[model samples]
Target: MYIFRLAFIEAQLTDAFIQFKNHYGFEVQVCNPRKGNEKGSVENKVGYIRYNFFTTSPVMNSYEDFTETLRVQLEKDRQRLHYEKEVLIEDLWNEEKKYLLELPVEDYPVFKEIEAKVNKYNEAKLDNTLIHIPKASNYPFIYFIVTWDKYKAVSPDGEILFEDFRPYMNKKRAIPWISIFKDWIRKPRAVSYSRYKKYLPGRINEYLLVEDLVVRKERLIEIVNLLVTHDIKRINEDFYDLITGNNENPFGLDWNEYDALAPTGGEQS
Candidate 1:
């Protein structure tokens, strides 16, 4: 049995911590109370890291990037001569690394899985990130595999339903405006109060910012349909061409020619 002892008077292994230990196949050695000698190396390393890495607060774009930079710095540090041995740390590491266990073929997923139900808008919320699920009914449940940067929503049978790479965090809504716009255009009053209104492209937003409520609603519907027809990336470019009566298609081919080239009945026409 692996024993984990904390300095707390009522120390006990948490279920989550035990599960983590089991998954990693590591045995913890616990020392008796007030026996500080057992963890001397650990204490020394913690102080060493605090002095070397955490003395100054770092401003970083992401935790993963910061970790990678720290790893590189540690590797560079290994080139220095050892204080007591008078030998390069890298030379010692080269010999030590040979005794280490080989890496596993598959990486262990370092994430927590949680059950989530699709909202009225067919979206699932996990780790404060809104994931868009297609063809999911309101209140339909899914399992969300969440990590720091990304997440995947899977069906009960393990089929992936939705996956997002750049997950929005910090109370930000990952709005699927195209779908929402379909409903909002009919009820323009709702659009004004919607949290997602701020995310709308400037051109479309300006077009819908009409003084007359009825006129704004009608224009919003037209704009939404146009956006749905083409990719969101080309929205501004296509919208400009459409309004300006430009004959050139953004794809470099006319609509009729593109449609003719499109596959039909599971095969190219």
Candidate 2:
């Protein structure tokens, strides 16, 4: 059995590291925080592995594929006789295997807890998803427990309120217009302070920054309806067309249609 040092992680352990240690049954010998002598083994071994096995990087399809490559390489390397003892390395491992502790009964669940704050709308935003917390207007702060696969929002008293699977990798994720529309319709001023609006085109962002609430709300409604299909990139082109006063309307609705409708209702025609 190998004597494991907790210093491999850090001198002062974090909560996550403590859980990792308990799960793996690692020996807890912590060294001086930045001492070179104590960190020598960890640093040298990593460099040795990188130079010896990874001189030519291997192309891997997935994590499983990479793991299988490592396992096969290790088994094959063990077939050779030991450099010092001159006995088969595999035989040495076989004799030493009995002293190793058994694996843990249950696999360690990988997750982290983060402190989150609720917006005025009683919603907690994580990435692009907004989780609604009903009757939580007064409760501004909460805990977000997240794993690679899922996340759950917990109240101060440790109640799991909202839980959902997280997107693995949304490289080009777009905030849907529907989610934006319902929220922004109430508060036009909030648009200038929005984090998501930064992603919109400079022209659209500039257009939305107006003192007229009526005009702002109307333009936002039109923009949201234009983006109803959620083709943000294409809709952005449409927005540029409107700003540039082009004849081609990508949304297929005349900008003056609202004025016409208002005039018709004036005469009750």
Model 1, residue 244: what's the lDDT? 36
Off by over 4 Å in 2: 1-23, 32-34, 56-65, 118-141, 147-150, 161-269
Q: TM-scores across all candidates?
A: 0.64, 0.45
- Backbone clashes under 3 angstroms, per model: 0, 0
- For residue 28, what is the lDDT in candidate 1? 76
List where candidate 1 sits over 4 angstroms from the true fold: 1-37, 115-137, 140-143, 154-161, 165-175, 183-187, 210-221, 243-269
lDDT of 1 at 210: 63
Q: Which candidate achieves the best TM-score against the true structure?
A: 1
User: What lDDT would each prediction earn against the true structure?
Assistant: 0.64, 0.66
Cα error, residue 262 of model 2, in Å, equals: 35
Which run of 10 residues does model 2 get worst, by summed lDDT? 260-269
lDDT of 2 by residue, 1-269 (tens): 99977644446678888998889897888777567899897998788678877989887865567789988987887898887899998999999998999989887888888887888766786766665554344577988788875677788888877666554423233344455555677888778786556665544565566678887898788777766653555654455464335556533544442221111110000
What lDDT does model 2 reach? 0.66
Query: Cα deviation of 149 in candidate 1 (Å)?
Result: 3.0
